[model samples]
Target: MIRLKSPSEIATMREAGRVVARTLAAVAEAARAGVSLSELDELAADLISAAGADPSFLGYRPTWASTRYPGVLCLSVNDAIVHGIPDGRVLRDGDLLSIDCGAYVEGFHADAAITVGVGDLDDRARHLSETTRLALEEGIAAVAVGGRLSDISHAVETVARGAGYGVPPNMGGHGIGTKMHEDPHLANTGRPGRGVRLREGMVLAIEPMLIESGRDRARTARDGWTVLTGDGSRAAHWEHSVAVTGDGPVILTLP
Candidate 1:
């Protein structure tokens, strides 16, 4: 069932969302060349704990996963699209890094992700990251109170496809509330004016994962966590926890 947050409930979620936003910003700042992936995760864990919030992704095990997620942040680098486990791997200059973060506070949860280049990036790397960010902006703009859910999806697809990028199949956004993942899966590509009708108080996480290969094919790592582009082309992801309101879409995850 789709869960809608009350005004008060959304307020609580906003608090959690800010926590997530702050944590993500801190991690992104600390994400530099020569930094280890595990180091980033540790920084995030400490920030979340200091805020009296819990790391939403830590120990999380979705049905499709063979093991619990072992990191506070999903640190996807280069072709690792999502769910990249944080380990001893040190980052290098010019690596495209995607950071996915979530936080839980006062019975609510917020999720968001961002992609950044570790250092000076090539033209293709910078373009891919910017396109993903703009796709996220388009997706969130389509989250009108009375609009259909697919409107958001189509907006994302338009931006991504227009740039000759590919959206990974069956991997996009979702409803978020008390639990991290809720009902009503939102695909990154869909026909506009279709699917569930939007309503006030409904919160959605609109994330767009793009592949530079212009193909949807992808593969999961042997560890059953990290997702990689099939042809080894680079990928980027961006997301925000949004709430449908009478005025318009409210980005809860804004810092």
Candidate 2:
């Protein structure tokens, strides 16, 4: 169901969103070329626990996955598009990392993601990361009162498509609130002024996953969780939880 949050509820969700933003910021700062993905997960787990919140991603079992997710965060690297488990892999210079995190606080949930290039990244990786971030910002800007959900999707798709990037068709953003994923799915490609209409008190997570080459096809890894580009091209993802308001759209998970 699509739930419209009240003012008090939105305030509480802001707390959860802040925790997500702060956690991602800390993780990004600690991430280095020599660090292991497991180490980053450990740091994020500790931070979430210390803040009196629960790691939303840990133990989450989506319908398609064979087993529950075993990590506190989704750490996708290079060709890994999303849901990359944190294991024994160590980061290397010029590697692109995509970190997706979620937190549950006071019974409310907030999710966010970011893709960054490791030390001494090449120009191509840098461009991919920046474009993904800008696509997210543009999508968020389209989330306003009386606006259609496709406005948000169109804004995102235009930016990525115009840049000659491919957006994965199967995976896109969605509503976020008491649960991690909710109603009113947000696609990256769609006709403007279509889909559900935006209204005050509605919160949505706007995420754009862009592929560097080939079509929008994706495949799951043997691990049963990680998603990667079928053509083995590099991918970038960025997201933020946003709330529709009378004034405009408020980004809940900004640092």
Candidate 3:
């Protein structure tokens, strides 16, 4: 069931979102070539704990996974699209890293992700990252009272397609609240005027994952949790939890 949050509840969610945003910022600032992905995870864990918020991804196990997620953040690199488990591997130059993190505070949850290029990035990598960011911005802009979910999807698809990027199929965004994942799945590509209608107090996570090559074909990695582009092309992902408000879309996950 889709639940609409009250103003007070939205305020609490914003606090949770801030914790996630701050943690991600700290991690991004600390992320550098030669730094181990596991080390970044440690930094995020400490930051979340110090803020009195719990790491939502730690110990999380999806139905298909045999083991619980062992880190506080997902460190997806290059072809690894999402759910890349943080290991002792150190980042290298020209690597595109996508870090996804979540925080649970005051009985609410907020989730966000960002993709960044390490040390010296090439032109293609830089363009992919920028495109994903803009796609997310476009998606967020479509969240408003009386708007349909497809309005957001179309906005995101228009940006990606215009940039000659491929929107990943099946994987997209979702509603977020007390639980890490909730109702109202938001697809990256869709026809406008379709799907759920937006309403005040509704919160949605608008994430756009784009592939620089081929259309949206993905494969699960050997790790069983990580997803990668089937064509082995580079991919970028950006996400933000937004709430529909009386005025417009309010990005809850902001630092």
Candidate topping TM-score: 1
Please provide, for model 3 over 1-255, each residue's C-alpha lDDT reduced to its tens digit, 9 standing for 90 to 100: 899999998898899899999988888888899999999999999999999999989998866788898889999999888889999999998899999999988888899999998888999999999999999999988887998999999999999999898877799999989887888988899999999889998999889999989478899988888899989899998899998999999999999
lDDT of each: 0.94, 0.91, 0.90
All-Cα superposition RMSD per candidate: 0.7, 0.9, 1.0
Tens digits of per-residue lDDT, candidate 1, 45-82, equal 99999999999999999898888999999999999999
> Over 4 Å off in model 1, which ranges?
none
Order of all candidates by TM-score, from best down to worst? 1, 2, 3
- Which segments of candidate 3 are over 4 A away from where they belong? none
Model 2 per-residue lDDT tens digits across residues 62-81:
67678999999999999999
TM-scores, all models, native as reference: 0.99, 0.98, 0.97
